[model samples]
Target: MKLTKREKLFERIENHLRITARQLVKFDTEEETLQYLIDSSRSELKCDFVGIVLKEGNYLISKVWSGSCVSISESFPIKIENCSPTFLNKSITFDKVDKDTICEFSKLLLEENILTWFTVPLKDDTNTYGFCIIGFMNYVPLLDEMNRVFEEFGKDVAVAISLSRRKEVQKNKMMGVEWISQNLTLDTEMDQIVGKLVERAGKGTNAQFACIYLYNERENCFILQTPAYGEKTRLNKILIEKNYVLKEYFPYLETPGGPQLTVPLVIDLKTIGVLHVENKGSLVFTKEDEEILELLSNHVAAMLENARLYNNEKDHKQRLHHLLDYQQALVKETVEKDTFDGIVFTLSRLFSKTVMIFDRFMRPISYELFDVAEDELHTLMELATFEVYQKKNRDLWFSVDYDRNMGVWSVNGGSDLLGYLAIDITGEEIDDFFKLSIDLARNIASIQFIKQKIVLDAKEQVKDSFITKLLVEKIEDEESIIQYANLFNWNLFHQHRVAVLSIDLLEEGTKDNILEHQAKKSLLWDQIKTRVLFYDQDILFANKEGEFILIIPIEKEKEKPKVYWAKLYEEIKKWLALEGDKSKILIGISGKTEVINDYFIMYQQAVQALNVVSHRFSNVGFAMFEELGSYTLLHHLKDSSIATLFIQKHLEPLLKYSEGKSMDLFHTLRVYLNNNGSIKETSDELYIHRSSLLYRLEKIESLLEVSLNFAEHRFDLMMAYKLYDLYYSNTALT
Candidate 1:
């Protein structure tokens, strides 16, 4: 039916809102519905301009608009009272600009050449969402009637806004679940999981600020897991310093600015971390929003915990597999390979670090450098000193460097210390798995060392037997001795000299404990053997109970054997001197020989020479059998009981008489005999008066019941003096 202009406008408003309400429910989000409503009002409802100002806390935020001035109409914020059901109970129409309508919302319409406008509260039975404003540039009749119709239309728009938001919320919930199910797997990294978690939380709750903070148990603090909306550094500092204060506001905290929701990512009654979400713009978070985020947090926490478990299991399996492979390869390499290179190479590859196998002296036996520079290796080698390792406990892994980035494990072969296994830990974190891998490697190294030691010890036994038999002349055939020496890679047929080294390792009275003494002796012997082998590895060597036998090959006969022996003696003396003054090394060398059977005789001569040096030449470190002169005779008589008695019979009388006396008669008599019984020579050599020397001589002659004038008495006394010098002399005659 045809009606007046006011009735016609009312009918048009009803018809247009009815059509727009259907389309509004079709849209999925509130923004889409709001935009369609504004567009329909401006085009079909005969309005010059239309805009929606949604209530956000105590302010009205111009959300959407449609007009020529739409760009300037959107996002205009005006401070206002909080929205309530009774706050804007009716449509308020402004026919002209006045002081009551001179606010920011009116200014926006004035800028659009809209002189007339009315704002109606967008509300339903339960809530007043905001206001819908319709404006016109010119005045019109029935403006009050049009405002009434527009008020009714605004209710439909408010209901549409609510339905669309619910639909979007449901969609986000489904999408969040789908994202967790599809994207989060055992293989997902923690960063990816946390990133997705934070993004989904923000979307599900319509939050402008969202972040996840994972707890670092080692650091005892919360580390921000994803990029946060606010100042990340400031948030982190606040969270770290005031974690308990933040925790007191668990679930949600409403402030004057806005509302904040905090939900912990809990699993099995334990909180691993927290999920935080703040409302966007001027909106406030509801209890329902808190529940949604909490649900998401639960799922994410489970996923995070599962991911951690999966990674841990995978890492353990990998480490165990690597350990098994290392063990198998170590066994195979120890059996088939001749050295430790293969083992260390495999270990370096497994750990992705530089690996080294060092001997007891901290000398690297085998090493594999993976991505290590030569200069860095040199530094590591220099830092790994014998003194450094010796100060640490053995058979355990420990940080060896000052930076605590290097680890070393001592390898032990039963009672013997084999070596060490070391790795560079810089820029890496070491877990129990890492330690376990190193422990397995060192244990394998110990086994390899023990295996090698077994072979070496057996070879040493066979070599010792062969050498003992050769030295004692038990192997009668020279050909047999030559074959035995060849077994040790020695050419016994060459011109060689035998050297007997007697080591007086300890002082006369040092340690009374036998075990400690033996241990020190063994250590010293190892040092000496290592030094000698370093000098010449091909030299034939045998270890006796009290001495070490070395058969030194003479390369050139042009130089006298004494020259070669003198050089060797100086070297040995120098090394022994380094051992300290308490230790003395006396080397006695024999003349060169071509015959293998003469080796036995050379050994005897060398021993006799060592005995002479030990007994008569207390000031000397080495001596040659050829250089012994008359002292060579003392070798046989030195061990003879008859020689000892004869020496005691002559020298004992003189020794007993000279004691407590002003002049030494034994010294005078020996000088007299050495001077060919020339009285003047004896007196001059003695640096004494001839009368004093004669008195001492007469006393010696009377004590022996003989006269110095008789040759038999002088000869017997001379022979006795020679024996006395060989057996009884402690120092050289000065």
Candidate 2:
């Protein structure tokens, strides 16, 4: 096959135009640029086929084709190494035809007829973009005129494409800088700015959809704010693929579709987000589109940061104001008495939920719109004790949920646990309100504690004053003492015993005079109650009369009644020593009598005994009975000497034998006495032989030189024994 000059010249122009268009269109952007280049080349070359294939790394895709002879498959992927010209030429070829190259190109083109083929590498300065192919049914000879024209056109196209790309790059850079500056100055926040930026970028590149999917480094996932058309609705419906391309990459790039493009939003060299542009019209995005999207991504990254900062600042200011208000409330002195109730009320009103104040123990103090029964309060109090209180001075607010319905705020006053506040903010913003109220309540508690201390001190002083005056103004008249006793609510009707105590103040000196007297009265009262059951007794001092009155029951009106007198005397003496100074104090015990009307008799008797002991005795302190010994002595003697002598004379024989070491004699006497001097009982008690017991008794009568068998002798002996036992016990002697 031979080619005419006219045919060669046209083919040269066609090749030149295709190269020119390829350079004019950015490979990274509009795929249509390649198709347009193929169309123009096919029209001028008058060939059976012309097509442009694009290389992406080692893989080649037929980007554009124009020919009636065959249709280039869009989906078929070709390896750069397997392409015809890639194997044929290790160097540049000009106006040269080769059998292997032609055959390889023809096969790829699917041309069955004989043909000549020409292939050119789409060489840019750095690397091959792709290749151009032209096919003819007949072989053609290269003409000088056509070769010159082809060389010149190819050179011009290459320069034009390179220049066009540079121009496009500069334009994109300027637009990106302007967009960032404008976004920074706009009132829109980072999120809104990024959304709008991506949308605009999509529109600029004629994309079907756009989205700014923010990258969460912590989560290592993309978070798309505004999903492309139907994407958000389909998110749940669509299966997330392992390597799902962004929606904003290609038009008509559906499920199992054509090529797509995605640009990462890199700021500071880190991918913080992605810019997605979808071309739904079989439009694969070009390099220029990628460059523009990348520039837009930078602006989006900055805007996102700005928005985050703005939101943080706004939130910080809000928290600051809230804290300030809380602090002011804490310091305010006008705290409602029912702080818990007030908190509940305020919170319920503010947030429309029930609120409660609890102590650190989580015991609800007061509550609003809640049925807090006494038992519940107690239970809450018990729970509250376990909770920790955060100090009001510090910025610590702790919360806990005791149950589904119960929320607790552990209020504090510095490090010390004050108490807690609780509320059932079941459906409210409880967190913030509780913190504020609990702090306020803590401050209130501190102030209340101080106030209570002051009040307690004042009450103590008042009590001291009252007691001092009461003790000092002694009433002398019986009626007056009774009236004074009545003031203390003492019962005066029943028989009572008066014990007078004269306390000698310690040499170191007493405390308050009133306190000392009060202490004495208290001690006396305590002792009397502890020792005896004074069901109805009144103790009072008769100042002018100088007597202590004791009124006691006299069941049998008898003279010289001894048991009652002795008991009264001993107990009074002990009481006086315990209440007063043991070394220097006089105590007087009045006789027991049932003389209600004759109060003066008792008073006089007591006073006389006290005076007699004080004035007559040289002792620093003496009991009354010790001074007036007339009746006391007669009582002692009656139970002593006469009784002892009578027994000794009558039982002299028994006594002498007992003294002379006859053990049986003492046993005999004891048995005889226990048995009322009956010989039969005496014999039984001694477990003795009867005749032997009678013989011992006879000996006892002989030694005593008295008749023991006589009643009078028996009585005398009995009295003597009683007297001696009493005497020995008192004297602590055997």
Candidate 3:
């Protein structure tokens, strides 16, 4: 049975090709097929090295390589004038004696001590797809008859590629027909279907990483999910890369880490998602794997289509079932109950369990708790982390295990999450029917919630109007103001200070009406509500003209407005600083209320304080009108005549001396005042040495004909500087 070396080599090559081809389509993706092609070729066929080079425009790009000491070019442009090897045109062999483009690449084999190499074109009758490389460590002679086997190998590759191109449409249609016959209904969950496909794609393909991205048509984005074990998938995870589809990236599958294979999930001609596979080893996905994965992805899409249809049908049935009940409940709740508490009580009795309603900000607005423990309620609250309750994260539903002697069920709204609606049933287990009922309850709750919001919104609009009218119309009658506030459910007639919170980067963050601006406002309002509610319930969260108009209660009769505002400002500022990407906020507060009817006067003072702070302390986040003192008085001045004369008398000499000078006297004076006239701070601000700033200050004091040490003189100088600022600004405008 002993055969010649040539006979043995022929038999080995033939056996390897048959074995690889038989298992080729067994792979889930092209990446698995590629890894197998190279690794199996080296091990089973006893080849020294193997690689795949794919055609890209006028270049032969080495996609992947395997084996000891082997190497390949990353890119080799085809230059017919330079006699570049066109492996795509036809496969060929190489030796040391060959004088061709193969020799340029043959040097790589030579460097690896591989003296013999052969390339087989992976092509069909019409198109040359690419080529595969097999190199030998020692020079080996090949029989002329062996070319037939190589040709057959190329045919197998061609067949695989053809299958890949067709499976997305034709094969999927057949599977769709088979799926219904086999009782695989459309009610199957899409994620479950995708997970099965992805797991198989990675494991079957022998890929290091795999990812599937389902297109969300509504969002115009793709929801990406990857094999949990795939490190590459997690490391490069994106929330939703916009405007990308699978077909666009079909031509090239190589990534920064390795060669990847992408195939589309198509059902009924609509592409739903993309399946990607990556082999950890140095190899590109093979044509066979591509074909196999295409089939796999198409099957997944068919299942997804069924799931979608099932959901639509199921939703239609539910709507039809509940139409009457929903209508009756809506009318009764709106007409008879007309309040959140009444609606909550009705829902609680209907469900035979306590239900709690959280507002959009996660605050408990209404609830009917019958037997829930306080600690248990607290635990549930803690469970609503950013990823659980926040609309931005939007985790809609979760249920605790019923067998654990405790069960907590929760669901968001039907159309959109108005708030958290949760049920407390300690001993009850949930089935499909119970889940359906809960969904129905949530839909009913959404309707009622919307109704309540409409009523509240009307009240808010009236309140906004009332606040503005009080400020502008000079509504000084305390009894009239109280009655007006009561009508809108606001108690703003009490001793409450007016504060305005302005977002500094409103235009910057929310340009073109980006949703981030609205989300930011919601988050900020929640923070404000939490802080304000901690002190007392006599506070209002409202806004007018991009500013948060807060009517905060004055807690103590003896507490100074400056001290109280300062403390509150510090606490809020600390929280604001922790907001990673949020814009800076500015707060302006007026002096505490003397009487309820002075709401207009206090609001005016708050606005005036904000203007003065913007000019005098631009870097500060919060300022009170009482603390502004002289700055506040300057803002109150209507004409610049007296202020101009005062400024000219105090610093007229210094102004004259510094006219047309490069060192700006106005900037120097402002910096000195801002720094509390400290020599070091002034020097640092002006980027000057201490001696230079000291010299300027002494000269200024001499020119002003007053000692700067006296508080009265310092006050006069500061006031004069503020007046000069006003006069200069007015003169510039004219």
Better of 1 and 2 by lDDT: 1
lDDT scores for all predictions? 0.72, 0.52, 0.64
Ranking by TM-score: 1, 2, 3
Best by lDDT: 1
Give the alpha carbon lDDT tens digit for every residue of 1-734 in model 3. 89998888789889888878777766654456667778887887677778877664344566577975533554353332333456665567774236544445555555666677777778887767678888887877767776778878876766565555455445544654464345444555555555666666676556787777766676566567533326654333333444364445443442222267777777878877677887635445655456557667655677766776777678767756665465466458757765567667766775667677665545566777666656666555555434243434432444433432222333344545566666665555564555666666666667677776677678667777666666653565657657878885765645777887766554463765667767667667656555566555556766665557888777742467667666766667665564443556667788767765577667866776665555666577778877776766776676667777787787677667788987666568667877786878889879999888777777777777777667798778777766654345324312
Q: Which residues of candidate 1, in runs, are more than 4 Å off?
A: 1-50, 56-60, 63-92, 95-101, 121-129, 136-171, 182-295, 369-381, 386-408, 422-426, 505-520, 556-582, 618-620, 633-645, 652-734
Model 3, C-alpha of 22: deviation from truth (Å): 67
Number of the candidate with higher lDDT, 1 or 3: 1
The TM-score leader among the candidates is 1
Candidate numbers sorted by lDDT from highest down:
1, 3, 2
Candidate 1 clashes between residue pairs 3 or more apart in a chain or in different chains: none
**How high a TM-score does candidate 3 get?**
0.44
Candidate 1 lDDT at 673 equals: 81
